[model samples]
Target chain A: MFRHIVLLAWVAEATEEQKAAVEAGLKELPGVIPELLRYEIGPDAGVSPGNFDFAVVADFASVEDYMVYRDHPTHLGVIADVIRPILANRVAAQYSF
Target chain B: MFRHIVLLAWVAEATEEQKAAVEAGLKELPGVIPELLRYEIGPDAGVSPGNFDFAVVADFASVEDYMVYRDHPTHLGVIADVIRPILANRVAAQYSF
Candidate 1:
């Protein structure tokens, strides 16, 4: 499987409503996008004092399938409409496992 | 379950051997640590530009179990000995799912 993981840190001024919108937007993806085999998104658990605020872990059968998720209109809409406004930093990693 | 994901970006001067050693050290954790339910580590696949260099995804049954792995001597040793030396930046996220 190809795994794609993204860690996001929100800007200091980001509101709780904005973060919720981000989560709500993401939760809608797996149902709409068939190539997404596994989709998991969560807020940081606060076990660590300093850590990224959110995480996204998605799986695909192949890199091509992942590209489908990447370019899908729903996913792009979420990024452009909600996530980018509050996104302070992002760290992503993709690999075959 | 609780998930912990860490993204690492090494300095420009970091050597391949050093990165390999980091992987080698992490591979030993699941064998020695009972609390680590699932562990997946991989170098970035290069699909995205300017992504983090590597990722470590770990799962635990509960937050307490994750704490065990987090504080494990072997894991600490790796952070202190191998990873911390050449590390440029790190982003981590812990969550419950």
Candidate 2:
């Protein structure tokens, strides 16, 4: 399996509405993009102090499938409209098991 | 269930020997630290153009269980002796299922 993990930290000024919008936007991607074999995302539970605000773990069958999801128009739209504006920092990793 | 996700980037100057040691050290943590109910770690597969070098996703029954794993001496030792030295950047998030 190919796994794509993304950790997002929201800007300090990001409002709850904006945060929720981003969360909902990401959670819906799997349904909109057929290449996403599986998707899991949510806000941080605060167990770890000073951690990022959100986490995403998505899976695909191969690197090409992952790239298709990555560059898909709807995914790009989410990044541009919802994610980038309120972002503090982002870190990502792609790995295989 | 509670999940702990960590993304790590090795310093550009870090040697392969050092990176290998860190990977091996982390792979051994779940066996040594009984609090970890599940563990997964691996180097990036390079599908992403720019990304962290390694990823870790570990699971615990609860936040308290996660803390036990976090503060366990074996974990602390690996972080201090292996991870911290080569870490270029780290981003983490904790969340519930």
Candidate 3:
């Protein structure tokens, strides 16, 4: 499977309401994007202190499917609208295993 | 399941040899540590530009098992001896999904 993982930190002023919106926005992606074979996203569980604010894991059958998902309009819209406004720092990695 | 995802960027000075060491070091964990129900680690596939250099995704049966893995001496040694020296930036998220 090809996987994409993202670890992101939130801006200091980001509110609980904004976090909820982020969650709601992310929940919409999988159903709308057919290439996403598996999708899981969540705020940090706080088991380890100083971890990133949130994480996203998505899987695809191949890198081509992942590439399509990367530029899909729906995914970009959520990122530009909901995620970017509150994002402090973010990093993503894609790999096959 | 409980999950941990780490996205890391290597220092500019980090060599290919250092990266190979990191990969070799990570491969040892699954056999010795046993709490990891699943573990996948790799340099980025580069399907997108400007992503983190490496990623690690690990899953456990529960958060408690995750905690054990988190503090395992062998794990800590690898982080300190192998990873920390070459790490430029890193963000990790622990979550349940």
Q: Pick the candidate with the highest lDDT.
A: 1
The 10-residue segment with the lowest total lDDT in model 1 chain A: A41-50
Query: Candidate 3 regions off by >4 Å?
Result: none
- Candidate order by TM-score, highest to lowest? 1, 3, 2
* Backbone collision tally, model 3: 0
TM-score of each: 0.97, 0.93, 0.94
DockQ, 0 to 1 scale, candidate 2: 0.82
What is chain B's TM-score across the candidates, in the order shown? 0.97, 0.95, 0.96
Ranking 2 against 3 by lDDT, winner: 3
Residue-level lDDT of model 3, residues B1-97, one tens digit each, is 9998888899999999998899899889999989999999998987788899998999999999998988999999999999999999988899998
Clashing pairs in 2: none
> Which one wins by DockQ: 2 or 3?
2
DockQ, per model, reads 0.87, 0.82, 0.82
lDDT of 1 by residue, A14-92 (tens): 9999999999999999999999999989999887988999999999999999999999999999999999999999889
User: lDDT of each prediction vs. the true structure?
Assistant: 0.94, 0.90, 0.91
Ranking, DockQ, top scorer first: 1, 2, 3
Best by DockQ: 1
Query: For candidate 2 chain A, which ten residues in a row score worst on lDDT?
Result: A23-32
Q: Of all true interface contacts, what fraction is found in model 2?
A: 0.84
Angstrom error at residue A70, model 2? 0.4
